[model samples]
Target chain A: MKKKVLTKEDILHLAKLSNLKLSDEEIEKYLKQLEETVEYVKNLDELKTDKVSPTSQTTNLTDVYFADGETNERGLKLKEKYFIVKRIM
Target chain B: MNLHGKSLLELKQLVIEKKISEKELNQYFLKRIRKFNPKLNAFITVLENNQLGIPYGAKDMFCTKGIRTTAASKVLDNFVPPYESTVTKKLQEAGMSVLGKTNMDAWAHGASTETSDYGVSKNPWDNKRYPGGSSGGSAAAISAYLVPAAIGTDTGGSIRHPSAWCGVIGLKPTYGRVSRYGVIAMGSSWDCPGPMTLNVEDNAYLLKQIAGKDKYDATSSSIAVQDYTNEIKKNKKFKIGIAESYFAGIDDQIKKHVYKSIDVLKKLGHAVKPIKLLPPKYSISVYTILQRAEVSSNLGRYDGIRYGNDRNFFGQEAKRRIMLGTYTLSYGYYDAFYKNAQKVRSIIIENFKSVFKDVDLIVGPNTPVTALNIGEFEKYPFYGELMDQLNEPASTAGIPDLSIPVGLDSNNLPIGFQIMGNYFEEANILNLAYQFEKETDFFGVIKKGINNYKD
Candidate 1:
């Protein structure tokens, strides 16, 4: 697996996108630190992952215990409106 | 009369038995807060100032109507919530007093509390050394005897690690064990709020009061929590398992103290067995990756547009996670990094499952290093990176973990042992710690250099 080296420009763009207004002093320091962290994460590319279906969840969790529109006994009864857990599938 | 070093169990006993009133104890902490919090930087907002008139939980991170909820970030520095967290409501109903809110890493990012926009929380033991973070404020306050107990959230050892550095007890309950409805989110999946206290029994007792099902959190488990305090009292003889893998190359001073304590456990009619838990090295990588990935998702709400100061709001550390997480979860890199890490996480969980079959409980040296100086990690954003090495293994598996101060080092800083239990088996872990507390005055260790502490 080829290691993806993050260029200085790439680091700056990411930093900007993340809304990190890096001072002149922080740029050089973060360039190297971010490079190391990026490389640390990029090391995962060495693993074989072709056949696997990407899963974003650790468990196959469902709200079977606590049904929607109908509340269970966990203080949801205290208020008329409650926020539902939005599952991102 | 000496409240600074009293355990929660001891303090609660005094409160319940009328030896001391809860109001009096609350007043004592309120006085200490006024005296020392200025020097310690342990609080950001200190809602209700000294006391909650009635007693509100401190921690500016917790949202309460008319109270500021900064999450320690300057972005949402003035933001206050219209509602209170379930824990706070429960504490209010129980007549528990909240001294004042403690400080932390802005947005719960670092290991030491230095990242807080407010200022660093000084270790109560030695003002020079740091109290661990992002829950450092809570740990420092509890350790300094400002408050008998306080609540902090744990994600990648935030609660437990801080407790160890400050020489107190910290608990990270099973994932989804506590509701995350009101507390600001750090890493959504891993964020869990638990207690930090002066001893194991106090942590256990507070945990019982807070642990329950929450309807707001779909991830919150429906399992019933046992009376953890009572569970600790049963079965004097216990099967305590020690992690040989985690101990392989820990600092000799900490390793020596842990093993010596194991000897004491053996003498107490309990069996300490060497268990083959997975090596802890990859967990740092695995956890940092997963938590960063969740950081991308969880912190997205803080666009400074809707929530916190998105533009100039977060600290350097928060920005680092946002960039790292967004990069990892970006268009092309998901499979190798984020996806593969979860599989590795599964393998780690499987290892925990296999080990639990043989050992009744698991133990290891809690942190790779003890309390460090305030500015130690100023150059590097990841403060105390090595100490985080051992904590993530159990955290990734969603198992309950406890860190208790076992003894002090040559420098007299507290050394802690991390104990883990089967998923949702916090009662057993508390029992083992309670038994150890009975045998040794574990909470008896004093803040050695307090008289000479400096700003």
Candidate 2:
């Protein structure tokens, strides 16, 4: 998968949606700060996990019995992933 | 009646024993506010007409029904919530008096209160220095002994950072330990409201009153509230881990004072060891993205169409964060920013978890620097980044971290001790902090006086 790299214009567009009217002098500050932040976060992008299952919850609840079985947000997890994929794609 | 230097617990005791009346305390404090607030600028609005006639607590971001919860942002300058925040309700019910509203960074965006539109909160220690912030006003008011204690919300160290710099006690309870309802939403996933006091006992008592379940906040955990005051009174010496990189980037004088404070603990017979915790560099990086993302979304409630009454509503910093957050969480940039930050957040949490395995608690400076000149961040806004250096890590990990005044510097400004505990180990954290407080009466020395000023 080719990773999506964010451009300065992307931040500007997002900034607009956020209601921040950036001055011409300020675009570069966000770019540099966000870039430094993004570069640091790139470490997460480098992780290789071919053999290990990713951790979801910190606690071990491999088995549990519930009468009502609250499955509301749990099922939405699948829907959310699908939606996220479609949106990101 | 004038108990300016008393900690919250001491004040409560004094009030309960009838040594002081609430009216007298309130009048003294209201008088102090009138006397010194001109110099300190610690308040956004002091509701002198509230007719409450008492020294009630106030955190700048927490909603107080009818009093205004502007979050020190121009965005909320005129916006007032119709209801009281859960914590405020609890405090009011507990007979805590309302002094008035303090100021903060607009919607709690920046670490220094500089982001606030209402104006800056200066340190009571030296009016020129920062009181530490987004809870800078609460910290300043409390450190100046104006109120002795005030509720402060910690989102990425708003409470603890300022508490540290201001030479007071501030606690960031474990994630979900305190209710988030009524706090003007800043960063929900990371926001946990706590107290800034002049002592460990006061912090614990405040935590006891504030920590509990709330149906209003579904993410709030169903945890049993432990009496932290009693717990601290009967605690053992703890094995504390020294966080490696947290103290690394700090300036030399601060490093010297912190190390000497640790030596005091070492002499007290606790096993202290050097531990390689998560490199703290990721805290601000992860927090910045997540905070901006959340701020953008949560503040959408403040659209001129909804919360704000006028189209000209919203303050400058609130606007900046909303715009920044919205931009980051927007189309084409969501994954590039928010989701990526979340994944990195996972890594940061994992790093801290790995450290907690070996250590019962971690210790470090609350911020890289102690306190700064008021409004310094306004000129060099990037300096705010340096302020939350040690704060964001503990806050992001959602663990309990307490800051206590360690000692003052050559310039007479106070330095603080920060102790991070494993999840739900606030008992141990508070205990260790209490023991450290006992070792040196440094806090008492801090309150030598904020003497009455004549205008």
Candidate 3:
């Protein structure tokens, strides 16, 4: 199996998608770590999983909606509800 | 026995017989935590109160109302929860008091407690070594007799791995068998809250108090909770399966102890057989993918909106996982990485299911090696992940596994095995472990570390 080698650009793109800002040193460090992690995961290709069904969750659960009210004490603050971000317009 | 050295059952009996007051028991442990926590670094927050009945150290991952639940991360360093987790609330109802929030790997991301932002928890047996984590604080506290037992969350060997290294009993119950409400989420499908204790009876006693369904958690199982204490008292011999492939690459000293444990079981009249199991290496890959992907998704809520600090509070390990998760779940790599890992997960589950058809339980080493020296993480960057090689399969399969101390190594550090049962069959795991505990002196050996246990 060809190992998955993550490039520098790939790490930057992932950081953007993950809403994280990285320094140049961090990018270099993560590029090496992410590449190694991806290489380790590529071992999955060795197994013949053509016919196996994917297991997203072990239990049967769906549509987990809470009641409409101020019931959750762990809720977001008023300013947090709109989520003011420095970059997001 | 002194109050701190008694098992959960023994202490409960003391409470019943009026031999010791709850306030006295509470003060006794609180004093111990104050005296020993600075040395062990086992507790992130020590609550000094006079509450009753088997005071347990709860891993900071579980939210306690009005108490800071940090998950050992600076992000939530001062984040006090407004609501209590279902498991803790259930335990409180059954008279278990909270000693404090124990330390863990920040965000429960690493195998060693070294990743904890608060500081590392030292092994109770040897202060120079790590206690094993991300539940190291709870395991360390139990090992040091600071708390009789503690609640810990296991995603990929978080509970069992640390407990094994710390020389205690850690039981990771079947996923969904215990509620995850208010507990910090790492891998939604893989995270399970279980007990870390000095003996199997306490493990079973704690499980009975905290295991059940709750409307607050959709994933909580509706299957009735068994009388696990009664179940453990039974003396049924089981057909145990030993997978040679699982034992390969393990330390020779640890392997010798595991084989000796198997010999003891055979002498007790249980039929022991060698069975081929799914390769654990593949589960490691699958676990890496699924856990990171879920972590990326679950951690999205920590954007400094409702709670804690900004996302910048995430440690380097957390950032690494998030980046890996983002890349794997990206448009091009989803099928090749994320989807493929899940399919492999299905295969791993099927492999365990098939093996259980021939035998009631599976046994193997809990960790690849014993407790590591505190600075070993810097020497080997991937130390945590590689150590969990033996535990990933059962964790990914979401089966109940108990880590019990089988014996000690050359350095007197503990070595243990993983006892796994079929889904929702924690009773079988507990029964077998209880019988082993009765026959062996491993549990008693740990008690010798207690300072004031009156014979």
Candidate 4:
């Protein structure tokens, strides 16, 4: 597997996707750090996981369901069954 | 009456015998917190009032109803949880009160609490060094006797690493053993809430209170919770395995202390055998990718509209992780990074399952080295993963593991020896640790830690 080389543009794209606003200094810092992390994680390629299935959760549980008609307050501001939010144009 | 150097059980006994009222005991710890917390920065918030039950520190990651849960991040500095975490509720019902919200790495992202927005938690053993973290504050508070015990959640070595560095007992219970309903999610698949205490018995006792299925957390197991405090007294002999791969690249002093602990286990009639397991380096890769992916997903809910400060308040470490996760989970890259890491996680789980078929438990040095000095994380790009190399395997496998103080390094820092057990076998893990504690008293490491903070 070839290593994925991250670039400044890639950092910007990721920052936009993650809803984060990074300064010029942070972009430069992350370019180097994220590249290092991505490179380090490349070691996983050494294992052949083609035949194996991905484990989403460890407990061998299926169809875990909460009992019906159970409700708890979220503690957010509410008025007459409607949540209040900032007005947007 | 002086309550210094007393164990949780001792304090409970005092209250039962009327030697000290619970209110007085809480005041005693509050006085100590006022004195030591300034220097150690172990707590982000201290509850000076409401002294009705036995007091203990809670890692800031666990949400307490009507109390601030910062998670050591500026983003959530003012965010108070409206409902209680199952762990804290269980502890409170078990006659424990929350003393304070202890500091942690922001969003539980780093190994050292240096990343905490509230400031770093200094090691109780050496003020100049870090208390290994993101559970650093919990470990430090227990080490300094600021609180009798603390509850910390471990995604990957957050509890054991700090416990090792702070010379305390920390157990990372098998995934799904403890409810994670209100814990600020880091790695949802890997997050485990467990106990950090001054002694093995306290660790067992706390686990008994918090370990069980919860209707709130779907992943929590339905396995029967054992009376761990009683189970440890059985004095069962375990077949312990020492993996050489865990020792590779470890500090010489830590290796020596772990071997010495193995010798003590041997003296106590437990069998020790050499076993081959997957190298820890592989788990580091799997942990980093999967954890980052989870962090990105979890943090997405924290828009300023819902709660917490805006995204701009995220620290450098959290931003770096979130960006990496976004990149990996992007349209084209998900199969390569996120899915592959999960596959590797399954492989690691199978590796542990196979090894446990022959041995009852695995023991080794918990951290590669003792607690490092403050400001040392800058040298390594992936400092937490490297610091937690020996710990990530059990975490990745979702098995229970415990770290107990073995001895101190030449610098007078604590070294931790960890025992890894098969899935849902905390009783067995606590049994061996209890036996060793009875035989060696953790080399007086826990006692010496409290002696440094004499009132």
TM-score of each: 0.89, 0.87, 0.93, 0.96
**Per-residue error at B139 for model 1, in Å?**
1.1
Q: Candidate 4 — which residues are off by over 4 angstroms?
A: A1-4, A67-89
Q: lDDT for each of the candidates?
A: 0.75, 0.73, 0.87, 0.91
Query: Best by DockQ, which number?
Result: 4
Candidate 1 positional error at B372, Å: 0.8
Residue ranges of candidate 1 with Cα displaced over 4 Å: A1-4, A16-20, A23-27, A41-60, A68-89, B1-23, B48-57, B378-382, B446-455
Q: Which residue runs of candidate 2 sit more than 4 Å off their true CA positions?
A: A1-12, A19-89, B50-54, B309-316, B378-383, B443-445, B449-455
The sequence of per-residue lDDT tens digits that candidate 3 reaches over residues B16-49 is 7889888888888888888888989999998886
Error of 3 at A2 (Å): 8.6
Q: For model 1, how many clashes? A: 5
- Estimate candidate 2's alpha-carbon lDDT, on a 0 to 1 scale: 0.73
Error of 3 at B372 (Å): 0.8
Q: DockQ ranking from best to worst? A: 4, 3, 1, 2
TM-score of 3: 0.93
**Candidate 1, DockQ to 2 decimals?**
0.29
B-chain TM-score for every candidate: 0.93, 0.94, 0.97, 0.99
State the lDDT of candidate 1 residue by residue for B305-336, as single tens digits. Answer: 75545656677787777777877777677766
Looking at model 3, residue B250 earns an lDDT score of 91
Candidate 4 CAPRI assessment class? medium
Candidate 4 lDDT, A36-83, residue by residue in tens: 888899999999999999998876788888768865454466888998
